[model samples]
Every structure is written in C-alpha cells, then in structure tokens.
Target: MTQPAQVPDATHRSVDVPGGRIHLVEQGTGPLVLLVHGFPESWYSWRHQLPVLAAAGFRAVAIDVRGYGRSSKPRDIEAYRMLAHVADNVGVVRALGEETAVVVGHDWGSTIAANTALLRPDVFTAVGLLSVPYAPRNGFRPTDAFAMMGGPEEFYVSYFQRPGRAEAEIERDVRGWLAGFYGVLSGDAVPPADGGDPHFVPPGGKLSDRFPDASLPSWLGEADLDVYAHEFERTGLTGALNRYRNMDRDWEDLAAWDGAPITQPSLFIGGALDASTTWLADAIKAYPTTLPGLVSSHILDGCGHWVQQERADEVNRLLTDWLRSLPGRARP
Candidate 1:
C-alpha cells in the first residue's frame, strides 16, 4: 500500500513486515521513540507528539498499526492477535535499521506494547503505556469486566465482543461512530460527564457522544478527524471490530504467561476524566507490584479517553521527559 502524504515535520515510510507493508512516520535525528496508536485512530493520533519529541532531540516515529490507515489490512482475524501485533512492532523496529527503540503505545496499542516488551524485550529499550493498564495474563476476563460494571449495560467493551453486531452497528452509521469516539476523548462531549451510566447512550449508539463539548485538544482538529473518518470509511468497521472479537483468543493466549510482569522501565499516562481510569483503577496500582520497573503514572486533568490527543502539550512534555531518562539512547 502507498503511504499517505507526509505531514509537516514528519515524513511517511513503509516497512515490509511478515504480513505486508507497515506504514510509519519518522522525524528528527536522535534517540528513536516509536509511538503506536490504538483503535479507530491512525498515526495521526500522535501528530502533536512527533514534533515535540523531535524538537527535543529524538527521532520520533508513529505508526499505523496493521489494518489501520495505509498499512496492510489482512482479512484473517488471527493475523490481528497479540503475538502477531508484537511481531509487527519487532519487524518495524528492525526494519527501521535500529536494534532497539523506546516503544510507546495507547489503548489497544498499549496492550501490544506491554506484551512486546515482555515477549520481545530485545526490540525495545523501554516501554510506555497510555489509557489502558497492564492486565497480566489471567488477570481479569471480559466477562469479569462486565460483571464488575454491573452487567452488560455499563460496559462498552463487552458490547464490542458481540460477533458481527458491533461492526454492523458502527458501520451502519460511520459518521456517528467517529463523532462518538471523538466525543469520548474530549472532556466536553458526553451526557453523564462520565461514560458509565447505564442509561447513557450516544446518538445513533455512537461512542463519541461520551465526550465533552469543548473543541478537541490542540493536537486534533477538523482535518485530523477528517483523516480518521476517511480511513474508517475505506476499511469500514470489520477490521477494527475484529480486534474485539479476538478478546477471548487474546486472553487465552496471554494466559500462558501466568501473570508475567513487564521488567523494563515503564510509564503510564491517562486522562483523569476517562472512564477507563475507573475500569482499571486497581490494575494500575498493582502494576508496580507485578512489574518492579514500572516507574510512573500520571493522570492529566481536563483530558478524557484520548489522553495524548486530548491533552497534547502535557502528554508531550511527560513523554519527552520519560524518553530522555531512558538508560541508553537510540543510536540513530
């Protein structure tokens, strides 16, 4: 697949992975920092962080995970599983001509990054996660999540696991889906001020309605939203939705590790206002207990689910500082 036009201060590139071409944007010239984005978003999610990292003297790279943006979109659901996702990151780092890189991930990408560091520590010098906490293998099940939230009514993730239903619902109204996802990230977009009320529902079942109403963070603008919408429009919801469908398989696969903790220095960042914080509260606190190297956790005020994009300046500052503190800098 062809790469998209390079955004100013960043240039697009593709690296051939096991499945097909992997799309990435690289900028600056120092230690390498690879930024991985999650669901319903592309590398564009890190648009704000790229320049800041680069300006701070690091070669920042943001990638479109498999099946998102211009990257290869494989039809097989297994191809999107955790092991494959980790392999893809290994391939990207190797392909970039770097032996190791400072790896960072958000949302689904956070899961992958955590697993990558655990399963393939050679490829990452350090790791950072956002939004989601590191739920160890056999940590908790989706069914457990549903029950903890007081049944299906309070959990969107459980809703994601319903085969064919979520894709059909989101695809049936793409605009509303995009808007809802967008709304949840910005503090001003939702009805209950928190995304958890059983009665809370976005227009057309859209997820963005969960967000607050202020303008999106400086990092995300109408143009960025357009870019994401266009990508979703092309791929539809099938590929993305498949991610949720594989949760059981992911859980099973991860279970083999039996609570293996991430040994590398790590950081976690999230929007204080995001409902996910409520969901993973205990897991976050217990992370350091499980992984001795887990060093910091920050919850940005006024931000929601999309913490990086919703609070770009603060996220960028924290990320740059964390990157600088890594044991060894990227040679590049």
Candidate 2:
C-alpha cells in the first residue's frame, strides 16, 4: 500500500452557521469541490484525495463538519441533528463564495450530503456518496435492525442506540475499537458463506467475542490509527454518537416529504466487502425503483467501509471521471 502524500498545507477558514462556527480547510484552485468526512474521523481522512483533486484542476475544500477537529464543538445533542448539518454545508458553500459545488461525502457524511442535496438542491451540482445510501423517511416509524434483518441478523445498529454504552466501550479502548471496526471490512475474517452469522456484527457487537485477537488492516499504519484516536479522544464520542440518536427525529423531519426524490445527479460508491451495503440493500433497491433520477452505483471490489481511504486509487479515478462527466463552468 502506498502511503498518502502528507500535504499539511490546508488553509483553515471558519464560517458562521446557525448553531456555531464550522471550521474548513481549503487548498488548491479550480472548480469548487467540498469533501466531507464521517464519524470517528476528521478532515484528515481526505488527505489522499485533497491533493489529487487539487492537481486535477479543482479547488478542493475538506471540512471538519461542526463538532469534529478544530471546528465548533456544540454540547447540545439537538445541535448535531440533520437540519443543522445540512445548514452547515450550505453556509460553508456560501461563505466560500461559491454558488454550487460537487459534494462528496463518506459514511455518516454521506447521510448529510444526501440531505443537503435534497434540502437545498441549488447548492450542489452533483453528489458522490460512499458507504451509506440515501435513507428516505417512511412514516416516522421506529425501525430497528431486527425489523429489517429478521431475528438473528440483528444487533448492528442496535449497538449504536444503546444509551452511552457504545461510546463508553469504544472510548475505553480506542485502538481496540478502531481495529474491530476496520478489521471486519478488511477481509481479515472470512464472512459466513450463508449470509451473516447471527453473532457477527461490526465493532462493538457480538463479533468481538469470537475474534478477540483481531487487529486493523496493515494498510492502516500506526500514524493513521493515532490520527483517528486523537480526534475521538479529544471530542469524545457524543458528537458522533448523536448522529444515531437523531434517527427518529430525522425520520420525523423528513416524513413531511413522502415521495421526495433526489433530482441531483448522484453516485453511490461502496466497498463490495462492507456490511453496510447489506443492511441497506432494500433501500438501495427501492431507491432507483422508486426514484429514477439516481444516476449510477458502483461497488468497488476488495474494499470495505473506508472505501475512499482504503481504495484511494480507485476512488480518485471514479471521482475524477464523474466530475469530468458533469457539465460545469470549468473543465480540465
């Protein structure tokens, strides 16, 4: 695995959003591209992609969202909700003197990117999503993994809603948590041939019982691990954890739009090995089936949850290709 180019030349800027100031790092110069990071990560997650995008003749800006990194860390759980996240993106784009940008988001950031495109389609020319799909609101019902995956294949998302338990477990052992989270998707452990085992789930669930010695992929060196560890250690897990807590609220807020569709040209990129795809399989199928505007979907082979970082070459290729295909003010 080639190491990412260590370009520590990000120009920091802050924008006043509704809740607080959002910190962002802008580098390179060309057409605008907003790179958003996800849970348990900061803008550092896009270290590889930033310079590549910049070199491709695009002005790339990676943000620390609202609560992560040097950004404003709000104590209130409500402040980290979906609408607030969407507004932050809009505010950043406007503050940076751009009308529309190609929004690229991964993991939890994917959720917000989709919401931003839907809530303010005018702000984004296109969207590139990694890992998670656009979750549509369906009547504001409380749905769990058990309801979606039957009796045995439960405990994945349920682990997130366990009320201070997941955070406690992860915070107590950050390295262990990072290992478990990345290990499952890195193909270190053979998945059950017949779907997933009743006991197998990502990170803080039952899988830890079976694979006590599991470690993160060799691709993730100690430096990478330390970056994630330091951020989560400083910020604690509340900000990231609050994302799960607001699912119901998000569902309710989105419930008003019964059949809303994502009109923006959108792309779905996921690791062929990641289990998140399995969890949201139904929604993915239902999306294009219901809303025909979803342009393309790509499942990258030999990758996991951290698709962009783990498979930077393939990801950069796809992103550049997609950006080139789009009709924009500037072109390479």
Candidate 3:
C-alpha cells in the first residue's frame, strides 16, 4: 500500500469528474480505497469505516454517488444509467491522481463496486462487497427479472419502476420515509411471514404509512438520522429515484459481460438475519463459481441487511484484514 501525499484528519471537498462535481469525505494516507454509498444514503454512510480504514494505512475516499448528497443530480432519468455511474467512479479515481485502488460498496453501491471491478479491473485491483452479492449479467433487463419475480402490487421494485409514483410518496415526507425505511430494513425488524396484509410495506400506501413510530437502531443514532434527513431534504430523492428508473438501461448497458466473472480477489460480508441472506445463501455457496477469486465469505450471526453500519467493528475488521491479505498489500 502506497501512502497518499497528504492525508488529513478528515475533510469534505469536491472533485471534478467527467459527469459532475462529487462531494466527498476523505481521510487516511495510504493505498486508496474508494467507498461508494447506496440508495437513500450519502457519503456519510461510510463515516465509521473511514477512520478505521485510515488507521489501517489506507487513503479512504467515501463519495456521495451522483444522485445523492452534495453531488450533481441531473434531472434526466437517462443520466443515471449504469455506465454513467461506473464512469463517474472511474473518473473520481483519476481525478484523485491515482492509477488503481481497492473498491468497496454497500447495497446498490455493492453493484457499483462489483461492476467497476468487472468492467475495469486494472483500476480497481481488489474488491469488497457488502450486503449484496455479485450477480452476473444474464442478458435480461433488470425489470424483466423483477417482472419474473411476479409479486403483488407491493413488489417494491415493481412499484419503484412506475416513476413519479415512488418519488411522490417518499419525497412527500422525506424524514418520515427515511425513518420508516431504515426502521423496517434494519436487522431488528422481522419480516412477517404467512402473507399478511399491511405488510411491512403495502403495494398501495406510502413507506411511512406502515410504521407510525420510527426509531433509530443502535448503529444509527439520532444525529446520524438527522444528517440523512437533512441531505434528503436538500436532494429530494429525484436522483436516487432516477437510478431505479434506469434499471432497464443498466441491464441493456451491461450486456457485454453476460457470462463474465469478476476475476479480481474479492471478499463478501453479509448478515445472517438479513432477508437478503436467504436468497444470497445460494450465491455465496456458488461464489467459487461466480467469483473465482473469492478470498472468503462471512455471515455474522444475528446481523441484518445493514451489515456494515449495524456491525461497524466487524465490518472494518473484515475489510482491513482482506486488504492486508491481498498480494503486495504490505506497507511500512
């Protein structure tokens, strides 16, 4: 790991990329580790991991993806295409004056990091994916996959595909929507089985309608919640929603890697209690086949979808350990 020229304690700054200006929170002074945040989140999502990575001899640059936070939010739905997202990230690395670095992502960002590695391994040498596993492109539109899932009107992604509808509901009450979504998705929130009405989220109603009283989890504090709410209030979910609108476009864009596998060294960290775990269990099982260079796989018992935040220490340990394990990762 090579050190950065000047690694400050912590700083928020802007970097001009090809797509637009990106707001970032950076720390540390060693090998570059770019952290991409997911939906309904900003660069703040990686606050906990930033210092940890910095301490472990890494230059951690956590950026708000194009749509969210202080980054540019192009109104055109087409602007949020997958290829554009990948390009922004690649440009961020170049803008930072680095050739290559480790790439890490969570939730939707997981897809970003994985695809970035798949698409440009020369730039992202090693990869770390949290929450979501790497799903290979199957030459079908993402909407097609969701349509095949064939759920009720409440099938979340299907509902999101309707455009203006989701944004209307979510943006109507940004803070409430944030609290509701975070509340229901956390590890502590149990999904109702036996197909009950008024599901954790119904197909017709708003996200805030399901849970009247929204509270913060241990990992997510009131101050943290406030930060998220403030940013969402400023951005108004348009850019984030636009990403969903580009689902089919992303599927169309990634046709080049139909059967291609992510050949770089990779590590996956997921939560066992997370509903995503059940489906991804098989993916992890088949990881050797899908991610041929997978170094290890771990599912923390009782952890949930918000694995990195819910269990910051564990996640940081897993991430730094994996980076150290990479060939030539040693630094003085």
Candidate 4:
C-alpha cells in the first residue's frame, strides 16, 4: 500500500505480520514510540504526535491497525480479535528495528496497547493510553451484560454485536457515519454536559440522525474526512466493525491474563468531555489500582472523545513528558 496523499509530514510503510501486511507512518530517530489509532481513524490520527516525538529525539511510528487505511483489511470477524492485532503491533516494533517501543493508543487502540503491555512486556516496555482505561480481565464477559439489555436501543455496542447489520446501515453513507461518530462525541460539535444528545442510534434510523450538528467540526476539514472516506471505501467497514463483534470471544481468550496488572511504566490522558469517563466510570476510578505502574493520568477540561486530535498540543505535551519520565530503557 502507498502513503495517504492527504496527510503531511510522514512516510508510509508496511510490516508483514502473521495475518497480513500492516501499514504504518514513521518519523524521527531515537527510542521508538508507537502510536495505534482507533475506529474510523487512521495513522493521520497521530499526525500531531509524530513530528513532536521526532523533534524530541524519539522515533515515532503510527499505524493503520490492520483494518484501516493503507493496511491489509481482512473480512472475517475473528481477524479483528485483540490478540491478533496485538501480535501485529509487537511485530511492527521489531520490524522497525526496535526490540521494544513505547506503545500509545487512543479509543479502541488504547485497549490494544494495554493488552500488548500486559501480555508482552518484553516487546512493549512502556504504555500510554488515551480515552480508554485498561481494566484488568475480571473473567467477566461484557457481551453477557449487553445480552441482558432491554433491547439494542439501550447501547450502541449491543446494536453492533451483530455482524453485517451496522455495516449495511453505516456503509451506505460512509461519510455521514464518520461525521456522526465525530460530531456527537466531540465537545465543540455538541453542547457541553447536556446529556440530551443520544449516544446510541435506534434501528431504522440513519446514524446521522443522532448528530444534530449542522456541519462537521472546524478542526476536521473536508480534506481530512476525504482521507478516511477513501480508505474505508476501499477496505469497507467489515474488518473495522469486527472489533465490536468479538467482545465475547475476546473476553474468553483473555482469561489467561485475568488478575494480571499492567506492570510497565504507563501514562494515561483523556479529554474531560470524553464519554468513556462517565460510561466506563468504574474503570476510570480503578485505573491506578488496576495499572500498578501508572505514572500519571490527566483529563483535559472542556475536551472530548477526540482528545489527541482536538487537543493536540496538550496531548503532545503529556506524551513527551511521560516519555522523558520513564525509567531508562535499554533502547532509550
């Protein structure tokens, strides 16, 4: 795959992993810093951090996470499983000539980064999680909780539990679905702390119906949206949405890591308006306890789900500061 034409200041490359070739963008020269993006986003999601980390004397590499952007996109639900994705990430670090990398991720990517650190500390020496908290595997299946829901209308994840359903609805208007995902969760795009906007779109309704914003946020320009739209159009959302489909299987697969604490130097950053803080409040409160090596945790006031993108400077500052603070690594 080639580099995305739209994003600036980075070079794209691919790493051959167990399942397929993984696409990524790289910058700089020193201890490696790996950035993993979340759903509906690409390596461009880390556009701000790449240059900054490079400038601070660290090699920064951001990837498409298998199912997105210039990377290989597999159709099966099992392909998006976290362990497989984790293996690909570990492979990226080694493929890039580093025995270990400072792994950082946002949104669903945070879950991937945390799992990698927990299961393969030898490969991921340190971790930095954004938006999502790393909760210890308690042998509890999240899919079972969704199963007890009154209906799919209760939560979007429940709605996404079924394969082929969300893809049919959202892919019909990929741009709108992307816009709605950004709009509702974004602080600037919606009222602050209103709680009036619906988080889950009921069946038969277009995803855009939940996004009351007349237009996309100013920061996310049409040019940026085009980059994502083009990539998703090529890959389709099947592999991407497959992450949500395997929650039960992921839970069962992670039983081995149950009660295991993430025993690596870690940093966490989140936006105050990010819904994960409220919806997953239990995990947020238990973050330090679960992640024994948490060096710091910060939530930027007045920010939202797209924390790294929306508040790039703050995110960069927090990240670089944490990188400098970590105990001396053999590579660093």
Candidate 5:
C-alpha cells in the first residue's frame, strides 16, 4: 500500500454548534465536500483524501464528529443520538459559509450521511457512502435484530450497548486494542473463514479475544496508530461508545422516515471482504429503489472495512471522477 501523502496547506479550525464545538481539518478551495468518519476513528481517518480532493478543485473538510477527537462530547447518552449528528452536519455547512454541500461518510458515518441527505435534502445536495450501504429504517427495532443475529454469543453491537462495558475493555489498553481491532477488519489480516468471528463475542469474553496476532496492515503505520490511540487515550471511550448506546433511540427518532429512499445523487464503495458489504448484500441490490440516484457502485476485491485507506489511489480516482461528474458543479 502507498504511504499517505502529507496534505499540503491543510488548516484546522473549530465551529460552534447547538451544544458544543466541532473540530475539523480542511484543504483546498471550491465547492464544499464534508467528510465524516466512523467509530473509534477521528477526522484524521480521511488524511489520504484531503489533499487529493483539494487538488481536484473542491474544498475538502473532514470533521471530528461529536464525541471524538477535539469535538465536544455531551454528557447525556441521548445527546449522541442520530438527530444530534444530523444537526451537527447542518451546523457545519452553515458555519463554513456555504448553503449546501456533498456529504460522504464511512461505517456509522455512512448511516449518518444517508440520514442527513434524507432528512434535509435542501442542505446536502449529494451523498457518498463508503464501507456500509444505505438501508432504510426497517420494521424491527435495531436491538432486536442485533440480538437475533447472535444465537448465543453476543453480537459486538449488543456488547457495546451497556454503559462502561466495552469502555472498560478498551480503556485498559487503547493502543493494543486499536491495533488489534484495525488488524482483524483490514484486508491483510482478516480473520479466516473457520476462525471465531470478531463480530461475535463469546460468553464472558471480550471482542479483543478474537483479534488475530499480526502486524499492522500496509495501509496503516505506527504513526497512524499513534494518532488514533492518543485521542482515545485522552478523551476516554465514553463519548464514542455512547453512539452505540443510542441505537434504540435513533430507531424511535426516525420512525417517520422508515422505508424512505435517499433521492439525491449518491455514490457507494465497499470492500469485498468487509462484513458490512457481505452481510448487507441485499441493501446493495435494493439500490435501484432505495438509492435511485446512485451514480456508481463498486466492491473492491481483496479489500476490507477501511476502503479509502486500504485502497487510497483507487478510491481517490473513483471519488474524484464521481465528484467531477456531478451536475451543476461550478468548480472542477
């Protein structure tokens, strides 16, 4: 894998939102493209995309989503609910002096970006989803589905529901935990088919127990690990973990839009080996009705969960090409 390029002329700033401040790193100048990251990661996750998007003639800004990095972490669990995140994105665009923007996200952020476009199409003109496909809210409660997913062993999402349960496991060894988690989900160190699944925690066992013993992926370096570890180490995991704690709340909050489709122009890219893509293959197939405006869809063979990082050059070309293809873009 190619080493990440040092972003040229990157600038850092913070914007005040409803209840707290959001920290972001921005590069380039032109039509705004907001990059939102997923769990256990910060704005730095988009380090590879910043310079490329900037050079492509679009202002690329990646933010530390609320409860991660330097962003304000609300004390109440409800504060981390889905609507709060959507509100934060709206604040970000208005704060940046733009009327509308194209939003892209990965993992949990993918769901967030989809909801943002679905809820406020006027502000988010376009959307891009990486790693996870868009699945409209379903009939069943999220927790109920997750509970049934694990016949006996606790699904990782279910394990994260209780307050301080996963936090205790992660805070014990942030660096090692992060390295192990990133390793198992990455293309290079993905768990074997017969191996115990990392997504399901054995009774009384931690998720790290399933993490394979291995070196970091070629796409991730020691320095990169440090950036992630230091942030979680300083901030603690409560704010981040609270995201999982609010899944049931999100279900209740978004009941109005159940089965709704994101009608804005959209893009999707996922790793072939990623469970997010494999488990949700139906969602990808349903894109015709669910994501009718999707411009393109791709599954990068041999890649894993971290799509943009593991395959930076390929993802960059795809992103730039798709962004340039968007109708009515004044720049590029």
Candidate 6:
C-alpha cells in the first residue's frame, strides 16, 4: 500500500451555489471528473485519486459535500436532503463552466452520484460508485426497513435521527472517536467477532463503545487523522450527522425516480470485507437491472470500507481504466 506521490499543481477554490458555496480541490486539465465524498469524510479522502486521475490526462475535482470540511453548513437538517445534494453536484458542474462531466462517489456519495446521474443525466454523462452499490428508490419507507434490521438494539441510522445524541458521544473526543471508527472498518483491523455488532448500538449505549481501540489503518497516517479531527473539532459534528437524519425525506423526495436505473456508463468497486458489500449483495446482483449501463464491478479481496484509501493503487487503476474506456473520454 505505497502512498502516491504528492501532486504539486493541485489548487483550491469555491464555487457559488444557491444555498452557499462549495469548496473544492482540483488538478489536471482534460475532461471534467467530479468526485463526491461520503460520511465523516471530506475531499481529502480522494487525495490518492486526484493525482492519479490528473496524471491519466483528465481534470479531476473533489468537493467537501456541503456538510464536511470547508463547505457551507446549512442550519436546517432538511437542507441536507438527497435532492439538495443532487442540486449541489449540478451547481458544481455549471459553476465550473462545463456543460457535462463524469461524477463518481463512495459511501453516501455513491447514492448521491447515482441520483445525480438519474435526475440530470445530461449534466453527468458517466458515473462510478465505490464502497456502496447503487440501489434505486423503492416504495417502502427507509426508516421502516432500517428499524427491522436490529431486533433488540437500535440501528446506527435510527440512532442518528435525534439531533444531539451521536454528537455528544463523538464530540467528547473527536480524535479518539475518529481513530477507533476508522480502524475498526479497515481490513487491517475489524471489530472482534465476539463483541457486539458495530452497526447496532446496545440499549442506552454509544456507537464508539464498539469501535476498536487498535492502531490506525495502514493507509491512514497520524497527519491524516489530525486533518479529519481538526475539521470536526472546529465545526462540530452537526452538519455531518444531518445527512443521516434525512433518510425518509430522500425517500419521499426521490419518489418520481422510483425503481429507476442509471443508464450512463458506470463502474462499481467494493471491498470484500466491507459490510456495505456483504449486506447489499442483492444490489450488486441486481446491477443488470438497477445499473444497466455498468461497465464493470470488482470486489477487492481483503479490503474494507475505505476502498479508495486502503487500496489506492488498485482503485486508481480501475477508475482510470474505466474513464478511458468511456466513449471519447479515452486518452492517447
């Protein structure tokens, strides 16, 4: 897991959107490739991809996704709904002076990217999803499905519905919490099998209580941890957690696209050990229907939740190969 060389020409700027501004870091100069990150993470999560994509002869851009990093944080929880995120992605492309571009994401961003491609296919011609698979909107309420997942304990999503519940637990020690959370999810270290499930919170218990106290993941360094902890330390966890509280709203908002499939060129990469892959195996199996335009799908052996970071070289190769394979996006 050798780290990629630092990209020297990378630059940062903000683009004006309806609600506020989006802060992004970009490099290279070819076809536009917009990258959206997921929960508890920022553009920094794509540090490895930005350089690789740029060197592959394409312009690569990664954003802070509104609630994380330097992006604007709207006060209302409803503002973080799925439609709002889709709008932000649209605004980013328009603000960048491009008519259309490629959009890729991981974790929650995977859903956001899929919706963006679904709602505005004209603007995002191609899509790539990592860590999480694309599952179209369904008739059932999201909260109801999550509730049934945990028999006695509360699912993590349900636990996050209350505004200040998870905040209090995480804010108590941002650094330690981030470390434990990241460590337990990486393939290098997993939550003990004997211990209770990390996805469910015991009655009257905290999520971090199940986190591993082991060292950081192989790809994450002390400086990297500081970068994440510093942002949350200054901004608090309200903005980030707001995304989880809007599950039902997204389900309701995206009703029009119910059972819709992304028809644009698509790629999906997942970590074999990641719960996201194991839990949603059906989604991948249904890719033939849900992701009709999917070009390829790979589940990296021994990898974990952090697909891009944990296996930077392999992810970069897959992303670049897929991008080049797109019609007219190929480099010499």
Q: For residues 1-332, what per-residue lDDT tens digits would candidate 1 score against the true structure?
A: 32364568688889998878898999998877888898878898888888888888888999989888778888988777788788888888888888888789998888888888888877786889998888787767755755466343445666666667667767776755676566655555545465455223443453433544555545466776677877787777766767766776778887778788888899999877777777679888787676678767898777777888777888888887777777765232
lDDT of 3 by residue, 128-223 (tens): 999888888786667776676635545566667776887888877888778767766777763433344222345455545554354566678887
Error of 3 at 187 (Å): 1.0
List runs of model 3 lying over 4 Å from the truth.
Answer: 1-8, 190-203, 212-214
Task: Name the top lDDT candidate.
Answer: 5
Query: Which regions in candidate 4 have their CA more than 4 angstroms from the true location?
Result: 1-3, 6-9, 149-152, 191-197, 203-206, 329-332
Cα miss at 112, model 2 (Å)? 0.9
TM-score for all predictions? 0.88, 0.87, 0.92, 0.93, 0.97, 0.97
Quote the lDDT for 68 in model 5.
92
Candidate 3: TM-score?
0.92
- Note the clash tally of each candidate: 13, 0, 0, 0, 0, 0
Residue by residue across 1-332, what tens digits does model 5's lDDT show?
22222456898889988868999999999999999999889998899999999999999999999999889998999999999999999999999999999999999999899999999999999999999999999889989999998777999999999998999999999999999999999988857344878899988889998887788888999989988898888899999889999999999999999999999999999999899999999999999999999999999999999999999999999999899999876453
Per-residue lDDT of model 4, residues 122-205, tens digit only: 888899999988887786588777666546454677777777877888789888778778877887766524344465555565
lDDT of each: 0.76, 0.74, 0.81, 0.81, 0.91, 0.91
Give the per-residue Cα lDDT of candidate 1 at 190: 45
Choose 3 or 5, whichever is better by TM-score: 5
**For model 2, how does the per-residue alpha-carbon lDDT over 114-212 read when each residue is reduced to its tens digit?**
888888878887888889877666654655434555354456555566658767777887767766666556634545344554334543345344333
Task: Indicate the TM-score of model 5.
Answer: 0.97
